[model samples]
Target chain A: RKLESGDAAEARDNFAGFKLIKVLNENTRNKCIFVHGSFEGSDDDAVVLMEKTPFDKQSISAMLTSTTDLKQVMQNDIYGVYTSSPPPDLNGINTTIIYPATDRHIMKYSAQQIYLINETAEEYQEITLPFIESQPFSLQWVYNILDKKAESDRIIFEDEDTDTGFILLPDMKWDEKLTENLYIIGICHKRGIRSLRDLGREHLPLLNNIAKKGKEAICTKYGVKENQLRVYLHYQPSYYHLHVHFTHVNFDAPGMNIGKAHLLLDVMENIEMQSDYYPKKTFTFTAKEKDPLYLKYKAAGKM
Target chain B: RKLESGDAAEARDNFAGFKLIKVLNENTRNKCIFVHGSFEGSDDDAVVLMEKTPFDKQSISAMLTSTTDLKQVMQNDIYGVYTSSPPPDLNGINTTIIYPATDRHIMKYSAQQIYLINETAEEYQEITLPFIESQPFSLQWVYNILDKKAESDRIIFEDEDTDTGFILLPDMKWDEKLTENLYIIGICHKRGIRSLRDLGREHLPLLNNIAKKGKEAICTKYGVKENQLRVYLHYQPSYYHLHVHFTHVNFDAPGMNIGKAHLLLDVMENIEMQSDYYPKKTFTFTAKEKDPLYLKYKAAGKM
Candidate 1:
C-alpha cells in the first residue's frame, strides 16, 4: 500500500517497490528498528518500522525446523557461545543467538520499550485530565463484542448480569495457548465507564467479579493458578473502553510498569478507602511526543 | 582460591584449573548466564553467574579499537545488518551486533533482572516488615563516610544539617561519569530509619531536601537537566540504610521496576495525603526465592 507524504491521499491496495534511505532511530529495549526511505515510483518520504513480536509457544517449538544456516560466532567457558546466521534461509529468516539458545534469550530480546513520565498531580489535572476527557473515542467495537455481533467465537466466558457482568476473551496479542505469555482482557458490560478515573466504590462488585471469575475460568481452562497471574489496568488506556488486563506474572507484558499500570487489587483498595480515589488521586504516565495529548500539554506549557 | 563443599575451611589465594559442568539457567532480560561447574584442583561444586555490567562511556569508546575479526551475519533492505566477531580479540572481547550497531542495543542487552512479588498488606506486616525489623543491620560504613573516615573523595554532594542532610556519592556500579548510565545514591544523615516502610511525615523535610538538592547538584555538575533525571527510593533496598537513588532517565538501572521503586514525588504525595501511608499501604515487591523474607512467607504459607 502507498501513502503519499502530507497529502491526505488514500492508500492504494497494491504495494510496490521499497527503497532504502537511512536508519532513523533504533530502540533496542522496545525491539523496534525504524528506517526512513521511500517507495518506488513515489517521490514521498516513508518510514519503515520493523519490530520483534512476542514469541508464542508454537513459534518457539517450530524454531528447530525453521532454523537454518546457523554459524558459530564465538564460544568460551565464561561467556558461553554466540551464533548467527549469515544468509537468509528458505523461510527468509536469519537467526542470531547470544550466549545461549533458550526462551529467556528470546523474552529479553523482545522486551517492550517503556518510558517513565513524572509529573505533579496538578500537571495531570491541567494537561492529561482535559485531554483524555476530550478524546473522540468510539465504543462500537466494545458494543459489537458485548452484543455478540462480532467476534462471538472468541469469547471465552461471559455473564449477562447488568451491573457485574463482563466478557472475557483472549487478547489479540496472545496465541490462546496455556503458555507463560498468556494474555486476556475483560470488558465490562456496564456502559458509561471510560477509564480508571471513572472507577468508584459502586463498581467494586464488577471489578471483584472480573478478578475472581476471570482467574477461576483461566484456571479451569488453562490450569493457571491465581497467584501466577498479574491483573491490572492502564490508566491512559489506548482506548476508552473499561477493560482489565490479566497476564501471567512471568510474561512481562507491556503496560505493566508502575507509572503506567495500577494493580487491580490496589485499584479496588484505593476505591474502598475513598469512593473517588482514582478521580482525586494524581496519576503519572508517559505519552509519545507526537501524541495530540502531549502536544496539547506542550502548547499549554505544562510539560 | 577454593573451599571444599559443606566446609568452613579457609582457602589459599591461588587459582587453578577451571571446568564447566553444565549450563544452569540463562536470563536474557537480566543479561546474566549461570553455569554449574568446579574450579581446577577443587572438588567442590561451584556455580558461576556471568552478569553483564552496565556500560560506561570508556568501555563504549574502546569498542571500536577492541572489536576484531568482525563477521557479517546477515544484511537485508528490510532487516538491516547483523554482525559478530568469531574470535576473541587481544583484549579478550567478542563483539555481536544483532541488527544495528547502536547504544540502544547495548543498553537493552544489559537491563537488570527483576522479579515481582505480590503480597497483601497484612502479609507484608506479618512477613516482610518483621523480617526487616529483625535484621541485624550495621551502619558502620555509612557512619564512616559521614564522618569522613572513608570514601570522602567519592562524595559528590554533602550537607551537614542534622535533620535534612545527606551525603551523595556515585554508586559503585556506576562508572563515575555523567553518561546515560549515571547512578548516584543519597545516604541520609538522620539515622535509625530503614527502608521505605519506615518513612513518615517527620522524614518529609529530609526526603524533600534530597530530591531538590540532588537534582540541582547533578544538573550543575553533569549538565543533565532535572527533567532527564528519575529520583526514587527502593523499598526493599539492598541495605538497611535509608538511601535515595538518583539515576539518568535514559539509564535502565536495576531495581527501578514498578514493584521495587517508589518515585520520590509519589512518596511525598502519599505522605502528604496520609502521615503513615507507607506503613498502612499494601506494598508489593519481588523477592528472590532464596531471600529470607521469601522463606518466612513460605513458612507462613502466605505466598
Candidate 2:
C-alpha cells in the first residue's frame, strides 16, 4: 500500500532537515531510521507524525540490498516509507490521514509581531524612535541621542528590560521577602495618559505616603531613624509608567562608607528603562565588586 | 643788627600781603607750632615766622569758611603762600606747622609723575626723566615707583596680595626641616629664571619630580607604595615664580578628579606667556588633600 499526503510531505521535509542525524547514527550505529505515519482507527483526518526507529532501519537496509533504481533516495536523504497497518483485532488496515497545519510557524510569527510591538511601544514612550531610526545604531548615535535628550529633560531614572511586575509600592518596603537589597518602582499609567501630572493633588501625597512608609520600613529593618536613611529616586521614561524608585544604602556597615553607598545608589538610580510595555521588563544595576560600602553594609547587617 | 634786604618797602608790602597768619591761626587748634632759630639768632626772623603762621591762617580761614570761598579755591583763584620757616617735626606733637614747600601737594605731584613714568615704561622699558622743578622725597612713593617699574616689566607676581617672599630652593634632600610636603623643583635650569616658556619647561619637570618625591614621602610615611599616593598641585599665579607644590590628593581626588585634574593641568601647561618685557618672576603651588587610593596605600604601607 502507498500513502501520500501534505502532512506526510511536511513531516518528511522536517525529518530530512533534522541535523541530529550524525549524532543519532553515531550513537545508534545506523540502527535507527525515519518513518512517517498517520493515526490508525481514527477518523480519516488524522495528522501525520514523524518517528525514528530500528525496525525502519532494518527494512531500509533490506530494501537497499535488494533495490537498484531507489539507490539515490537511500543515499543522501534516505528515510523509511511505511504504510498504515491495522491493529491486531481489525479485519483490514484502517488508516486515518490528517493534514498538519503550520502551527509552529504561526506561533513564531506571532512572537515576532509581539516583539516588534513591544519595541515600537518602548520607542514611542521614550520619544526616540524618529531620532533613533534616523541614525545607525552606533556608539556615536547612541551618545547623540542621549545628549539631545539630556539637554531638554532631566532624566531622573531609567531601567532597560527590567521585570517591573515586582516593582510595587508595597513591595518596595523593607521586608524579609525581598531577597535583594534593591527594589525598582515604576511610575506608569494607561497608554496615552499623562500619569505623572494627573497623579492629582492626592497623587503627590499618596506618593509621599508610600515613600514615607517605605522609609519607615527600611528604618525599622535597619534599626535606624528615617533621617539616617538616604533615598535615591531614579526617573526612567522607558517604563512610561509614572513611578519613583527609592533605594537605600547603609555606609556604617563593615566595608561600606558614604562614598561607596553613593556610588551604588547612583548605579541603581541610573538604570535605564528600555521596554515599551508595562509588564515585560529588563534592567540591570552594576557596581564594582569590592565596593567598600557594600562590604561595610553587609557587615553592618544592612544589606 | 638789621639784615640787609632788597627793597625794604617792597618787603613790607610782601609781608602785608602774606596769608600765613590767617592760615596758622585758623589751624592752630588742630596743628602744632614749630620755631627754628636762624644762624644769626635774629629775633626779627623769629618774629617773621610767628607772624606769618597766624597771618596765613586768618587769611585762608576767612576765605574758606564759606561755600563761596571753597568754590573759589576749587577754581584755583587764590595765590599760594610761601613761608621761610622749616617744616615742623610732627612725631611727638599733637599739632605741627607745615611748610608750603613740604606740603602734600609736592607728594601728589610726584605720585602723578611716577604714574606717567610707569605707563610709559610699560610700553618702552627704558624711561628717562627730564629735569623737573620738584622731586619726590617720600620713601613710600619710592616703593610705589619700584612696584610700578616691576609691573611695567611684567616681572612681579602680584595677582593676589599674598605675603611676598622668595621661594628659596637650597641644595638639600626633602626632609622635615622643609615644609613637610612643600618643595620646588626647577625643570629647565637648576636655577630659576624670569620667563614663562623657560620656567614652564624647567619648572614642569621640577614640579613632576616634586610630585613624585611628595608621593614617595607620603608613601614612606604612611607605609604605602608611591604609585598609590595621590598628590595635588594648586598653581597660584600671584606668585610668578615657578615651583612644584606637593600635597596628598591623587589626580583623581574629589575636586581634583580626572576631569578637573586634566583641566587644571592643561591650564597650567598652556598658560599664555605675557609679553617678553613682562617676564613672570613668581609662581606658586598649593597642596590640596590626598586621594582615597593614596590614603589606602598609606594605610597599607606600600608607597
Candidate 3:
C-alpha cells in the first residue's frame, strides 16, 4: 500500500478517515467492545477490529501532534481505519471523534468508540449514534440481569414482559448509614436498552409502574410511602448500562448533583418528547483523577 | 508629608505594619463592619478602626504593593492603621489567605482570632467565650419574622419564648419533591446566638432541645421519626444568626455537603468539648458570583 501526497494532506487538515465505533454499553467487570462501526455510507456497515491494531506511542504522538497518513494502511482496515468510499457530503461528515487525527489517537485497541451519557441531558453529542438496531442487544450484562430478574434474592418485582425489574443489592454497608437511619438502595433495570436514550413514548408505563405500584410495595413492606423513596440515575454511570438508584429520601447518596441525577419521572417525561433526546444533548460533570473515563479524556488532551 | 528614600526599601519587602482587624461575620446585605483587629502584638487586646480612617485606593495599593512607613500618618490613627505599642512575638504572623482568592475564604479577622481548629483531628480547642451579653437579641430580621411566625397564615409553629420558631417558605416549588413530597424548609432560630462560633458548653441544652423535642414535634406532625429527619448548621453560616435547617432525609438540599453541613449532634458534641470550636477552625466552601463575602476578598486583591 502506498500513501499519496493528497492522502497526507487529507490526514493533516481534512482528516478524511473512518474509525470502528465501539459501543461500551455494559456496566460489569467485563468490558464488551463492539468494535465494528456503522457509518451510513461506509463500504461495510461494520468492520471488526484487527486483533493487532497499531497503537504504539509514536503513532499516538503523531496522531495528537502531527499529521497521519493512515489511508495507506487503512485500505484493508489494517490500523482500525477503514478506507471507505467518500461519503456524498464529506464536509458535513462528523467523522472527527472529539478531535483531529482520530485514527492516529487510538492509544489502545479498546480505546476507540463513542460513549453515550444520559444524566441531566447528554455529555457528548458530536459523534453519531451507531445503527443500534444492527445489534439487537444494545447493552451487555442485560442477558444475565434479565435471567436473575425473577429470583427472590435479587428481584423485588417485575412487569408483564419483564423488560423492567427491581433488584436488591447484596452489600449491607452501613458506615455512611447510621443504625437508626435505615437505607435501601436497589437497581432498576430495563432489559435490552443501553441507557436512558432507549426510553421513549413506549416506556411511559414503566416509569408510572415504578411511581405507583413500586412505591406502594416499598411503603407496605418498609412502612414508607413512594414519596420517601428517591429514584434516579447517575450520568456517565460507573458502567455504561442504565439502571435507576432507589434509596431513602433521607440518605444523602453520591451522584445526586443536579447535573448527574436524572429523576425517573423527569426521565419519563423527557422520553415523552423524544426517547433519544438524551444522546443528542451536552452535559457537565466532575470527573475525578481515578475515574477510567477521566483517563481517556486526559490521554486525548481534552482534560 | 514628604516621601522618604528608605520607604522604597521597606515597601519592596517588609510588610511589618499594624492593621485594625475588621470582623466580616454577617452574611446579610448590610455588612456590619466590626472594625477592629487583634494580633499577638497589636496594642491593647485590639484597636478599633476610627471612622475617618483613610482607605483610599492609592494608600491601599501602596500598603499592599509597596512599603508602608505609617509613621508619617502616625500623628493620628489614619488609614485604619492604629499606632499601638507592639506586643510579644511580632514576627509570628499567619496573615496569608488562600490563592485565586475564593470568596468563601475567610481572612484573619476577629473571626480568625477565635479560630481554634486542629486541621488534622478536626477538633476545636477552647477560647474564652465572647460575652454575647452585649445584645440580648440575635438576627436582624427577628422582629418581623416573629410577627409572621405565630399567624397560621405564615407561621408553621412557635415555641414558648417565641424565639425558636418555624415559618413556611412561600414557594411550593419542588423539582425533586413531587406532589406528596411536601417540603417545609424553615428557619429554626435560637435567641442571642450570633453564629456557631458563639456556641459554648452553656448552649448545649439548646442543641439537645433541637435533637429531642424538635425532632419529636416534627415527627409527630410529619409522621417521621428522629432518624428520618436531618438537622444541621452551616459553618460560615448563610447569615450571622444561628439557624438550623430541618429537611426530610430524602431531600437533596443545598449546603448538604459534609464540609458545609455540621450535623446537629456533631455540633452539640463539639460544643460540649469547646463552645468556641467553630471560630477556631478553617473551612472550605464554594463561592458563587454576587456573594458580598466574595467581593471583600476581591477588593483585597485575593481573587
What are the TM-scores, per candidate, against the unseen true structure?
0.71, 0.18, 0.31
Q: Rank the candidates by DockQ, best first.
A: 1, 3, 2
Candidate 3, residue A268: how far the Cα is off, in Å:
2.4
Query: In candidate 2, how many Å is residue B97 off?
Result: 39
Give model 3's docking category. Answer: incorrect
All candidates' lDDT scores?
A: 0.61, 0.24, 0.38
Per-residue alpha-carbon lDDT of candidate 2 for residues B1-303, written as tens digits (9 for 90 to 100): 544321121111111112221111111221212222121223222111111111121122121111111011111111111111111210011111122222322222121100000112221121111111122323331232234531133211112222222222211112222121222222122333322323344244444444444445445544544322223332222122333333222111122211112121222333322222112222211111142222333344322
Ranking of candidates on lDDT, top first: 1, 3, 2
In candidate 1 the C-alpha lDDT for residue B152 amounts to 85
Of models 2 and 3, which has the larger TM-score?
Answer: 3
**Which lDDT tens digits does candidate 3 get at residues A1-303?**
322222321112221233435432111111011233433333333222211111222222222111211121111100011111111111011111222213332333333222222222322431212322333544444445556643346445554345545554322443323422334444455545555655667767666776566666656666654444666666545544556666555554566544356566556654554565455434434444555555555564554
Which candidate number would show the highest DockQ if scored against the true structure?
Answer: 1
What lDDT score is found at residue B279 in candidate 1?
Answer: 78
lDDT of 1 by residue, A1-303 (tens): 343223333322222354545444433232333444455665655443333322222222232221312222321121212232212111121112121112332333332222345544576677776877787677899899999999999999997788999999999999976568989999999998878988899999999999899889987888776767778898688888799998876676766755677788778877887787777776767655566876776688765
User: Alpha-carbon error at A239 in model 3, in Å?
Assistant: 2.7
lDDT score, candidate 2, position B256 = 27
Better of 1 and 3 by lDDT: 1
The TM-score obtained by model 2 is 0.18
DockQ of each: 0.09, 0.00, 0.01
Interface Cα root-mean-square deviation for all models: 14.0, 60.9, 32.3
What's the DockQ of model 2? Answer: 0.00
